[model samples]
Target: MIRTIVGLIIVLALSVVVISSVPDYSLPSGLQGVGQDYTERGVNDTGSVNLVTAVVVAYRGLDTLGEVVVLFSASTAVVLVLTLVPMGANPTPSSSIVAFTSGVLPGSIVLFGIYIITHGHLSPGGGFPGGAVVASAFLLVMLGSNKIPGKSKLLASIESLAGVTFGLLGFWGMMMFGQFLNNMVLPAGSPGKLFSAGIIPLISLVIGAKVASELSGVFSSYRKAGGDE
Candidate 1:
């Protein structure tokens, strides 16, 4: 244990040193103008009021794909942990006040998460933040309802489906426009409208569901373990 801790500290120190030493790089002169170009293209070509969404889903979709993979890995880790332990081995009682708060707060949080996800194409919050919010709501649910069982298989299925759907969507884009994950085929409606961006909202929904289910599954497993004890 001492060696492990020491090794971890050394690794962290090395990472910090290396990361700090990385040279600062600026955008190319022509690329420096890309923000304005992206904004204009977002408004006209993608009809997305939020330039960030346009950049993430349309311009830099490969990065978004990587982010989804990270979320998937998190879900997989949770599933693996839960599977290693038997259910109903430990039970932990939660305070009534906490239960009440969890129940009441999660509803508002769910609504807010949806709002953030849907308006991602028009504002600051996008899939990542929105998905995190949704996961928080699920965590609340797991804490509040002790009797409720987590649907691990279902959650895993949803995560896998979302990942596959994203991949297929990217592949379709490649087939259509010779660029993977391109959103050009989407009908660019009026900027600021709910239906403006074609796949951004869809992707957000998938992300939200994936995050919520995975986190809920993890929380439920932990809660179940506590209940057993």
Candidate 2:
């Protein structure tokens, strides 16, 4: 009861702060808040045809990186929690189902995910969604078979390396231009092309790999814990 009262007091304080921080009480019409500022400046600033990608992976990169870190932390927390419980023996494998799902579905999902991650500068999708799609392939693998041969370590390693690479690159930019995760670290080539948008695409790729690996590792851990039916 004391804990609940304290929690309510804290919540009330936070709500009051939020309410006081709002500049305008009335909601503006569409595009009034954001305006054309982002769209106007995005093309020249990041050189990505996809304004959303430029904003996410270039302009507001640090926030995205923080989000990835949160995801990674959540996955780690899950692993730690699951470690308290003893895992069961591996389930029985189905040869035909495993063979077909492993052969066909994973390949297609991975290919499409890669396409989305790579072409992010030119298209609608980027690292987060694409990585989720790629991780789905791993889910399919887990659901289809009992023993997944020798990829969990690799995935974990990739996830770690990608996260480190992202941080290092951000520091590299800070060294060069006094800005964390500066988009100007690399040359921004022609827009709407594969190699355009400076470090945006590179960051997207790293985020994609990290997200995919982290999610795959989590799903694999759950399956190992006998959460699978």
RMSD of each: 4.6, 5.9
lDDT for each candidate structure: 0.76, 0.86
* 92-197 per-residue lDDT for model 2 (tens digits): 7657867576867888998999999999999999999899999998788777776733335798789999999999989989999999999898988888889989
TM-score of 1: 0.77
lDDT of 1: 0.76
Residues 83-135 of candidate 1: C-alpha lDDT, one tens digit per residue: 68776643455689978899789889989988888888888887778878888
Backbone clash pairs for candidate 2 read none
Model 1: CA > 4 A from native: 1-33, 86-90, 148-150, 227-229
Q: CA shift at 158, candidate 1, in angstroms?
A: 1.9
Cα displacement (angstroms), candidate 2, residue 83, comes to: 1.9
Which residue ranges in model 2 land beyond 4 Å of their true spot?
1-30, 33-35, 92-99, 148-151
- Candidates in order, TM-scores: namely 0.77, 0.82
